[model samples]
Target: MASKKKRVKLKSLSQGRPPTLKPLHSLSSKATRTLISSHHTLQKLRAKAVAEGDEAKADAIAKEIEERGGIEKYQHASLLGQSSDRGGDSSRILMDWLVPIVPALKQHASDGRQMRMLEIGALSTTNACSNSRLFEMERIDLNSQAAGIKQQDFMTRPLPNDTKDKFDIISLSLVLNYVPDAIGRGEMLLRTLEFLKIPHHLDSGCQEIFPSLYLVLPAPCITNSRYLDESKLEMIMDSLGYIMVKKKLSNKLVYYLWRRVSFSTKRTCFKKVEIRSGKDRNNFSIVLK
Candidate 1:
């Protein structure tokens, strides 16, 4: 008989000190992802507990969040993931998609006003969009990690009353997934419409230079979810007056550019419906109520 092979089991990320406890400079790719995911999950749990009026449960979750080094650590991990060695930055994708429309955007900006952008959940102020001359970017996050990023929650941000107040582009990269509940995610999607500039006309390019949404989400949320897929997402956006112009899918993420075509479409009722059945499928979903 062959000698029994001795197998070594790697220690789980949660087995010891929380990944966030490690120095930011020393955090590995796996550790960074773990920290960010754990933080987002804890936030969801805390939100649910509060909504259920369970103060004790909410307090306990808050304590755990503190012990896990708070939002600071999570932001650090996110920043680390944006470093050149890890994946450079998400803005690279946004820039790639915007390249074809640069000339049109430039013509629109010739009126002595730069194109405006509201980048929610922004981690860096030095990304591609920030460095571009054509865009005046307003970067915001729930927790500020740098001097330029304002500490503001997008949900509570005042709705724009004028086109000048609205943005030519609104980027919600890795933001919808941070919402704790399906209803919240739906609300977020609806809220974005209020912030985008009303398009006057379509410009010449592979994509329209009209007001648009640059949405980035984890691929698994749409690909492996029990309640969501590409079709469902397209349906949801269509009902919201958005038409997808460009989409890119990677192993880990999905990117979409949705132009606001019709501004007066009524909201459609979308409930949590199982679209896929698999033991391994995740429960990611968005409900438009």
Candidate 2:
């Protein structure tokens, strides 16, 4: 009798989820571990400085942290990967957000303008933007020895130049939460602004619009974080010539779909007006969407 073949049991795929990989820490390289260790050491020093009421020392540490890419240097994929996320629901949320936008992507390639995309903080996945399969994808991460994921810093990397408006979309999923503060997060938005395509052909009433973003950040950023909230984000993105096309504040994550639109025509879902008291400050006006 022929020996029975042993089969490998697989995780459930009924929801079209990516196969679960080994934990990110186990898959991290020695260099990743070293960075994480250094970051933690700095954190301990920072805490001690704060406890000692050494304002100068704390400020110095904060400056150093900012120079080293803020908390992102520490909490990046190099350390937590998707583990910081809620049951790793980020992947599903992003995939769902991305799939619907696929049809909105530019279809034809004039002058060899094939669709491309940048996936920052892509954790151990080949198909970073599962929606744009035809896109010439580039994936970057500080950790995760995933095949094709380059260990590169997205903050400092120069935007693509040779291909003018080559990329049609960028995905920054569960990455912004790693930044230390609101200013750092705003700086991130500023740095990544060059990646989008703002077509001048809008004068022709072309139904085909430019590129957009599928962003996922921790919910605290929108709900209770000291520096960040939905109102602030809207103001920043509006100033940058983008508007939120869709949004979801889930239990663990705040997801947004932002597409390029004319600044004059932008409609912010959340609106507020700051009213000040006599030589003092009044709370902001609330017009909930």
Candidate 3:
């Protein structure tokens, strides 16, 4: 038999093409090694700082590392581009939504005065309270020990009846999620509005206390064990005579802007309230008279 023909296989390089690329795993292994080495270097630097008793320098280095990844990632994305005086982009976005409502609130306020605002769970200290020109901001929080922000216990005690007619705007930001139970959360909502004097006595004539409210919550709000669903929260607000005027959803949070449609209007002297409850509901009429 004739000698078997020699078999040949063309290599990629031999075909005048570059060799096929390796898988990402192969490529990334080297990169990962380098990153680990860099981390070790940073650790060494920190160790040196401590050994030399340069506590400030050590702290600075540690802070840099923290900023690179730690809790910084959880910081508000809109705050990424911001300065101290001007407030963060997140605050700006909130303000943009709030500006239109200002005039409406001002109209309802006594003597067309600037509206007072209350910000709950304002952990960052950069909420509407920072914007002096836009609102007279007051702050409240259940967590008195949280760093970097002021706190007040608006839940346990209602806002004084005398002051109920003072605030024109109220904000509940990322707070309802932390309330431990549904009954407590519902009570918190009622107490919060009560402090603002929402259900003004009809005999008193719309005293114009807290005409608007802005609530920023996680859209579904069910991811965290402490959080209540948005629907239930909305139902609670409806029961209190607040109407949702604007709703916005994003990857980060859901914002609802609410306004009082009308005060209690009833021929009877009884304080009967009618609030919008279902998804199809459009208007709420409260009879506080």
Angstrom error of the Cα, residue 216, model 2: value is: 1.0
Candidate 2's residue-wise lDDT over 162-223, tens digit each? 54744566878866654432334455665566776654453122223346677886565466
Worst window of 10 by summed lDDT in candidate 3: 12-21
Q: Candidate 1, 68: how far from true, in Å?
A: 0.9
Q: Write the per-residue lDDT of candidate 1 for residues 1-289, one digit (tens) a residue.
A: 8444332221211111122333355688999889888887887777666666666767788889878887678778888888999876777888887887788777867966677899999998898889876788899987767899997878778888788899888999988887777877888898889999776655566237458899999899999999999999999999988999889898888999898888876789999999899899988899998
Stretches of model 3 off by over 4 angstroms after superposition: 1-91, 101-112, 143-150, 163-165, 199-210, 222-233, 262-289
- C-alpha lDDT score of every prediction, in listed order: 0.80, 0.54, 0.47
Best by lDDT: 1
When 1 and 3 are scored with lDDT, the better candidate is 1
Q: Which one wins by TM-score: 1 or 2?
A: 1
TM-score for candidate 2: 0.58
TM-score, candidate 1, is 0.88
Model 3 TM-score relative to the real fold: 0.49
For every model shown, what is its TM-score relative to the native structure? 0.88, 0.58, 0.49
Please identify which of the two predictions, 1 or 3, would achieve the higher TM-score against the true structure: 1
- Candidate 3 clashing pairs? 159-195, 264-286, 264-287, 264-288
lDDT of 3 at 102: 56
Q: Give lDDT: candidate 1, residue 32.
A: 89
User: How far is 263's C-alpha from truth in model 3 (Å)?
Assistant: 5.2
